[model samples]
Target: MTTTAPTATAHRSGRRFETARQVADAVLFEGYVLYPYRASAAKNRMRWQFGVLVPPAWAPAQGEHSLQRTEVLMEPRGAATLSLELRFLHAQRRTVQEAHADGTFTDTPALHLPDRVLVPWDEGTEERVELRVAVPELTEKEIVLPFNRPAREDTEPVLDDHGRTVGRLVRRTEEAEGVVRLHAEELEGPYRVLKLTAVVENTSPWTPDGPGTAREEALPRSLVAAHLLLGLTPGSFLSMTDPPEWARSAVAGCANLHTWPVLAGEDGRADVVLSSPIILEDHPAIAPESAGAMYDATEIDEILALRTAALTDEEKREARGTDPRAAAVVDLAETLPPEVLERLHGAVRSLRAGTGAAAAPQEPAPEALFTPDTPWWDPAGSAPAQPTPDRVLVDGTPVGPGSRVTLRPGLRRTDAQDLFLQGRTARVEEVLHDVDGGVHLAVTVEGDPGADIRREQGRFLYFQPDEVTATEEP
Candidate 1:
């Protein structure tokens, strides 16, 4: 797409990708999270959730809510219709009771559980729910779908193994979906920036008003996955997943990524990158300098195959006993050759092993955006020297220095400066404790330490306790 806007002033165009292809390539890139980003991580693997957005009620006490807004600079092709396709997983609450062979009570059923354990609750269903698209930059804004549902009653008895009478699980729900539209006139400026906001409300109906203490007033909600697609005039959208060339030229200037309307190029092409609302920053779970980080994990496929080379009949049965989601991985590990697992141990070493403290800082690779001191899984790369209170936990992990983190889109500091673009990873440098005992963190780019400094402080960038998460490893 070409723009007639004058390039009289040479500025960084926030534009990183000219098409959606570029955005997809970067977001779905390898190691974007880690080698085993999606693995069960039950035994010895990494499980990453870089782009997860949960409802406020379900979110950790110190974590951000599901509300999200992204600012993007778009040159609409003459009042084009912008379509957005959102995908997410819906979570429903279920009262769970322990089962016994005698079919007796194993204590009162629990209302809420901390972690998302699939065994107890119903299988999560992926949802493409719609919401009213509100843009403060536009002329008109309103909710496309309003909450409306007739009250009804439904109840299921919570039974025991003996098939006896127990408490009831009652619920009511109403759901609807629609699209919000914006006209060219609603958009402003030759370089129009539309602030898209989506407010997901509790569509589920409240518990039936009746006697008995098994009442559930709250309803179920969904969690949005990180990946989102904004449909614009054929090729009108450009990708801003990475930094512009102009911003990369200066060591200190690169830190300006938190600022927007970055002059992408001389063609008046600019890109505005949005950050994740969730903070993935925290100390590493694994110890720094641990052997797990040093081993050549590239051989993982071969090692897993070798370990499962000879699965015993008994071991195969044990594997099937595990969670179905993780049965395959368990099967491979159980039958893996002991010799192979032992031999592969400690085969990897730190990428910074030989570099001395005073060693000159190395330049980032041409395609690199944020450079860190070590790989994501390495203890040194994730763990903090000084620990802080555990408040915001991502995927059940805390935020700490050396830990890799993901920022929410349109994130801002107290002064309203962009925190960092959403859907990317950054490394924690240090965890700060205020006089009030509030916890914060100082973080830097994954591989680019140069981008770590705060332009305002001339030092590392600091974020709130919930601004980041350790969920997304570097």
Candidate 2:
């Protein structure tokens, strides 16, 4: 099978592909670096904590894998075609070398200059391998595509104001080899359903220097943040998470190893699929309010920007010298205008009228409660409907404040603390409605010594209406 280098021109041809690309970029740098953005940060030392495909030779010892397999069901029209883009990062070791007067350079961890400082760090360079094949071809025989990127070294001379070379930065990249195997099997059913399987493996040859070899040593030869983006013409892929009733059994039979396949692009579009290392729902999207990539996928952009802006001068200087991306992050946080920063404070995607007992009562105007200078974030300005008198329907039972109930945490509990609260009896303190119109029950555990204190402090454990059953009063 023939593979081609990915080009922007080719990607721009398809509007659906472009949408998928945006989400893919976010996944590529999900954990490229962490907060503090300095090379010396302890958390930053252990980098590439995502879908890393290491060499087969060292994978067993490191307890990591060398391959990722994604399987999805697709319904293709006559002579449909599939395009695959495999994207990943290649680790590059950057060494700082100070120039000596004798026409030689000596390696240094850091080189301090008049205006700036340079530090040795590992950086990532993006790599993409693209291929296209016909659906009929995949069904006939499995296609194996092998790709190799040769190793190389590059140097950048750091010059002083006098045009003399003060120091130089040398970046060395190790060779990487990988293979992609694609095959399809037609499933038995009334409708023509095809199960497509794509496997990516790291075939780079590597040898450990010693038994004590570390993960960092193996990363250079590994495929960091490896993932696949699939686009189809005249075909739609099924959602594994919530497949149709008819295809549920078939979806469950497919094996996806170390990767999750989710529909990409528009909310209802199925022409594209993103097989990621991180679990996501169908039609995943990047929030529009996001400033840019912050490398920490689980963090709030506003909080990270605030923390980055709050770094001391010394810390910021160190972060700026770490990597070009880190320097950009520091500049973005510091130079962001107050108005733009305010936009990152909060965002509500959708709002609708509440339902059942969770319906909110109209409140008086803000002017009646607070002065014109009241801050937007002030509680009084956007106070929630009084929760004490509010009520929510639990299994058609009206549960309100002072109501007794038995706690039953949902199967998908967000907090681990809920495990201890399971099956416990509690008294409903309030019934609350969130910005999204979802109802929650704030309750205090029964017979707790600190229940009165918690009530005074307004601290209570919250549960969804479905997570509790109304009980008769004692």
Q: C-alpha displacement of 453 in model 2, angstroms? A: 13
Candidate 1 yields a Cα-based lDDT of 0.37
Best-performing candidate as measured by TM-score: 2
What is candidate 2's lDDT per residue for 338-451, written digit by digit as tens?
A: 977887876543232223243354422211222234443445546576544498788898889999999999888978888888888999998888757788889999989999
Tens-place lDDT digits, model 1, residues 251-342: 12211111121222112223222233222111112222222221223445445444444545434333332223234554445455665465
lDDT at residue 212 of model 2 (Cα atoms): 86
Candidate 1: count the clashes: 58
- The candidate 2 region of ten consecutive residues with least summed lDDT is 363-372
For candidate 1, give the lDDT of residue 256: 17
Highest-lDDT candidate: 2
Q: Model 2: residues >4 Å from true position, as ranges?
A: 1-14, 352-474
